[model samples]
Target: MAATALAGVALVGALVAVALGTYGRSHTPTGRPLALVIGFTDMAPMKAWLATAGVLLGLAQVLSAAWMWGRLPIRREAPHWLGQAHRWCGSLAFVLTLPVAYHCLWSLGFGTDSPRTVLHSVFGCAFYGVFASKMLALRTKRLPGWLLPAAGGLLFALLVGAWATASLWYFTQPGVPLK
Candidate 1:
C-alpha cells in the first residue's frame, strides 16, 4: 500500500508539473531556479494542444506507475496481457513527450550556459533513454528481469529528483529562488 501511495503521489506530482508547464503560468523565475522556462508562455491554440498532450501523457504515466505498484489484480502469475497494455501506454507516452522535450530544448536556447537548465535537459534525455531501453527490453521479451527493473528504478529516481527540484522552485519560491 505504501508503494501504491507513493506512486499515486508521484502521479499527482507529475500532473502538477504538467500544469505548471502550461503557458501563462503567472509564475516567474527567480534566483537559481530549477526550470528555465514555464510551459504556458504562448498560451495559444498550438501550445494549448501541446499542454493537453502533456496532461494526457502525465495521466498515462501515473497509471503505468500505479500498475507497477501492483494496485491492479493484473497478476503476479499469468498476468502478461495487462502488463503489456501498461507497456504500450508507456511507450505512447514516450512518443508524446518528444515534442514537449524539443520545445524545452528550444526554450532553454539549446544549452547555452545554464546549469539548472542543462540539468533539466540531461534529465529529460536520460529519462527518455530509460524509457526506450525499457521498451526494448519488453519488446525482446526480456522483461521481468533486472534490466527492465533497473531502468524503471532509474526513471523513477530521475522523475523524483526533477519534479522535486521543479516543485521547490515552482511552489516554494514565494518570490524567492530555490537554494
Candidate 2:
C-alpha cells in the first residue's frame, strides 16, 4: 500500500514539473510584485520575509505533528489542540507561499541559468506536487499511518530546500536590499 501511495506521489510530482515546464516565459513585466507584502520597493525583501515565515510555520507543523503522533517526550496521548495547531500552521504556511509562487510562475516561469536557480525551480514544482500528495493523503482512508508523516516530512523538507535556494541565497548577496 505504501508503495502504491509513493508511486502516486511520484506521478503527481512528475506531472506538475512537466506542466510548469510548459509555461512560456512572460514577456510582460512581473505583476502584483509584493502586493501581498506591501510597501517593499523590490520583491526580494518580501520574498525573503514570506519564505522565512514559511520556514517557521513549517517547523511548527513538524513539532505539532510530533506531539500529535505521541513521538514527543510527553507522557500523555495526543492532545486535540496539537492536531489543530498542525493543521492551521500547515495551512498558513501553504498560504504564505502563494504570493511568491505567483510571482515566480507569472514573471519568471522556470530558468536554469545557474545551479541554484535550477534547483529552486525544480524544487518549486516538486513542492506543489508533494503538497498535493500530502493533501490527498490527508483525505485518504486505509493507507498505512506512516504515510501522513512521510508526506508531511517530504513537504517540509522541500519547503526548506526551496527557502534555502532562494531566500537564503538572496540574503547572502551584497547589500541585502529591502527596496
Candidate with best TM-score:
2
The model with the greatest lDDT is 2
Q: Model 1, 8-72: lDDT tens per residue?
A: 43454455344434321233322222232345333122323443454455556655655766655
Per-residue C-alpha lDDT of model 2 across residues 1-179, encoded as one tens digit per residue: 76786677667767766676556243443544545657776787888888889999999999888887777898988876777787899899999998887788777767577999888887787888788877877776667877778878988998999999999999889888854
Please report the TM-score between candidate 2 and the true structure. Answer: 0.86
TM-score of 1: 0.48
Error of 2 at 32 (Å): 8.4
Q: In model 2, where do residues sit more than 4 Å from their true spots?
A: 1-6, 24-37, 76-78
Per-residue lDDT, model 1, residue 98, is 54
State TM-scores per candidate: 0.48, 0.86
